[model samples]
Target chain A: MEPRPTAVRPPIHLRIADDIRMQIERGELPPGAAIPTLAEISERWSCGMNSARGAVALLRAQGLITSGRGKAPVVRIPPRRVIRSSERHQIEKDLALKPEAERGAIGEAETNLNMSIGAQRFSSQYDQVEAGPELAKVFGVEPTTLMLRRQWEATDPNTELRLSWSVSHIPLDIVKSNPALLDPNNEPWPGGTQHQLSTVGVEIMKMVDEVTARMPTTVEAQLWGLPEGVPLIFCRRISIDGDGRVIETSDADYPADRTELHFVTPLRPWPKRRQA
Target chain B: MEPRPTAVRPPIHLRIADDIRMQIERGELPPGAAIPTLAEISERWSCGMNSARGAVALLRAQGLITSGRGKAPVVRIPPRRVIRSSERHQIEKDLALKPEAERGAIGEAETNLNMSIGAQRFSSQYDQVEAGPELAKVFGVEPTTLMLRRQWEATDPNTELRLSWSVSHIPLDIVKSNPALLDPNNEPWPGGTQHQLSTVGVEIMKMVDEVTARMPTTVEAQLWGLPEGVPLIFCRRISIDGDGRVIETSDADYPADRTELHFVTPLRPWPKRRQA
Candidate 1:
């Protein structure tokens, strides 16, 4: 027979938090529903006020609820998700060969956020820096090699919060032939990064996306307006040439609570009759 | 002009945590080094013991340090990362056509964990369940559509901790033609899922991986042996046949601190000489 509960227990605060979390998960406390008060929790669990406070804190830290000093905690209403699909890689490459008029009509900012660049302020800054040890290793370049680093950001003017941000780095030798590529003023750069490379007679044949996640630091949270418990999705995208040479690398961050990173893989078909 | 610090303080504990977090980032306090004690923190920050305790708790929750009742908290030494790459999708598809002897020689456990299946305990549980509204929508089937649900997991025998875990779902009608597909006893199937689907005349020509992340629940944290601050990377992989029909959907989670998801997208080459 299975042993009964109450013999061994986790910390009182953890138990209390778990109970509340279950209620939230089960829809007993639906989104926007208020969490129980401290007094009510203490009474329900027969725990001290300290345990009750800790339970609430835990819930907030877990991103299950939203609370402020003057407001009662409520179940967090999930934000609308934004899907970033790998298919865009092909689309961007295709755009590079499209008519200039067609290429100028589309911008990643619009496709990514469903908001036009006109609705948000866009900025691009470029500078040259030594690749240093880590970046040089990634680019297979010497530590003394200079690289052109470009930072791009789209921000909501009203909130002064970033809607999208990324940094791209390329070895100076690779793109120095195209002066436009080194100038920030030339961006929006109709056709995006692929076109920029195309202008320099470079053709990207492959891209690799490396993804991971981690909790946001306090400054990151404040900047992103993130609630507690949300993690940031980080992706480093490496664009490669036909010769398998790494040409450029770009890194970006997305709020996991509202981002869905989609990767699509197309597999080669098996030989006829192989299925049998 | 930027304002100076000390004018706007974000809680004493937050300040303390930020200081230590910076130290960790800068490698001032290398991994495995002891964190400052409550007494030291309090003295340095000129804060009370409660604030000091809160700062330490915050660091632990951020997954920057590890501590237990009797042991001093120390900067966490990151675990060895295991990479799960999308390239494996095509590898599995190719393996489905290989000779039985070669296919049988390889198991996912070996490829995924770099360990032989003989070194761990594996389990496969089969069950029949209604697709329900959510899953029905995903598969474009009725709510009551019978689905074959299979849970696969591998565990280290000594620690009883999970090495890998995933749940797969396939509409019963799609795989019922092959009875072996529904039987748990047929596991260790020669070429894994791709081959199993082949027996049912399902050819997965495409696969889409959807990934997100969040803090693991208290129970999940325990099962995964995750320290504080680590998040779980959740992936839902959907397999689509030639006609773009969804055949199988699988969900799995990986500890973010020790997992890297790699996605490779091969771009079509631009027209020759179009690079100019």
Candidate 2:
């Protein structure tokens, strides 16, 4: 069906921006290619310089292009994506049962960032807080129960930007059995959290991952050095043990421009076909 | 951590915007609450109206607030999320083998939106195109192979916005045995694509879902009636048959403002502990 004739045309600046955006999307203006100069855009589109400037600003804000102060803008070159797959859940559980030596060689850092733990700047901070209503519901505990919160981060030494960030919450009663788990210095935590839980005789049998995305706050943008238009993907992982107890909930953020969350589902075959 | 005193201060407008963002994040300024008017903000911050306006624009750009021309701004109230889980792959495969009567009850509309197919303004358009290099790799076919492309949409009549949208591609040679598969009218096809493929002797044994997100184009925003700062989540589902040949690839988009992608991973228990 034809669009309504009464539909309003977009403002001049938006029209110019959308045209450039399409060029970028179609790869006519390839990644790292400089955007046309303001004069050229104004000449071609028959618009004022301010309109041309607005178009560029819109492109930058949408994260389709990048520029430094006083620098010419160019289409952004997408970052190489790092796959973070749901299959890692089983891998981590298997690592938990390995001897410490083998587990030591395959730390969380290696699996997540494909970098050795010793080569990156990693930090872990531990604290405890009363389980509020939200936490209580997830843990099936009283609101007064103390929950241990562990915030973990891995930063790129050269860029000083976070390579990974996640915070985990577990009812203190569940892990207090192992005092070693309470110490921050014990991390890089070989075999990571799964091993830590194994020491307390808790086994994780299920991990449910909930994923969503949102634009980052200004502070977050600065921290990640995110270009405009990029969204941050947030994943909340809930770990449940065989006894149907919620063991831990960890939330992590990934810059959407450079991350792919892959989930593989293998289906069961149908019952043997009846007489043909 | 305490030694970095050389950081530059953010601009006044940015600082104000960050403060309001923090309030919203902390739930102090709950969703749907009105943002302070420009006059009030200028008075409180001792800044000019232009500065206050800048702050509000930043908030809207970040998708934390919603405003209309000549209307006061308010914190954005998120829509109710509809979860699309990975477990549905198994469910769909199971449904493909059920009796036609049973399959009739569980159409794609019922599963994704919890709305009956009859309630939606649904559309399907079938076309054919040569497999491009990118799609060729996915389907493991020659670049010149003809592929049937089906675009499907379900719109909410009241909003006139799409409730669901997806495009699927399958090698024409694979499904040509069933001419009905190439016809658009056959859809809302009983049982969906899985059942359609079953008619051609294909059984999907695995599905790999790759998920990412990005800011929507202006056209997308207008079509979805999305407020500023909302991101669109994109999921590519690759369906592989029992012989390991990729049978179909479908790409779907969901607005992050009201959608959640969930993946459930069930882990196997570790080998039993050896004698201590």
DockQ of each: 0.67, 0.67
Docking class of 1: medium
All models, RMSD in angstroms: 3.3, 2.8
Q: Model 1, DockQ value? A: 0.67
lDDT for model 2: 0.88
In Å, residue A246's CA in model 2 sits off its true spot by 1.7
State which docking tier applies to candidate 2.
medium
Residue B175, model 2: Cα distance from true site in angstroms:
1.0
lDDT of 1 by residue, B82-191 (tens): 99999999999999888888889988778788467799899999999999888898899999999999998888876667788999999999999989888899888999
Clashing pairs in 2: A62-A229, A63-A228
How far is B9's C-alpha from truth in model 1 (Å)? 4.4
Model 2 error, position B245 (Å): 2.0
TM-score of the second chain in candidate 2: 0.94
Task: Write the residue-wise lDDT of candidate 2 on A121-187 in tens digits.
Answer: 9888999999888879988999999989999888877667788899999999999999999988887
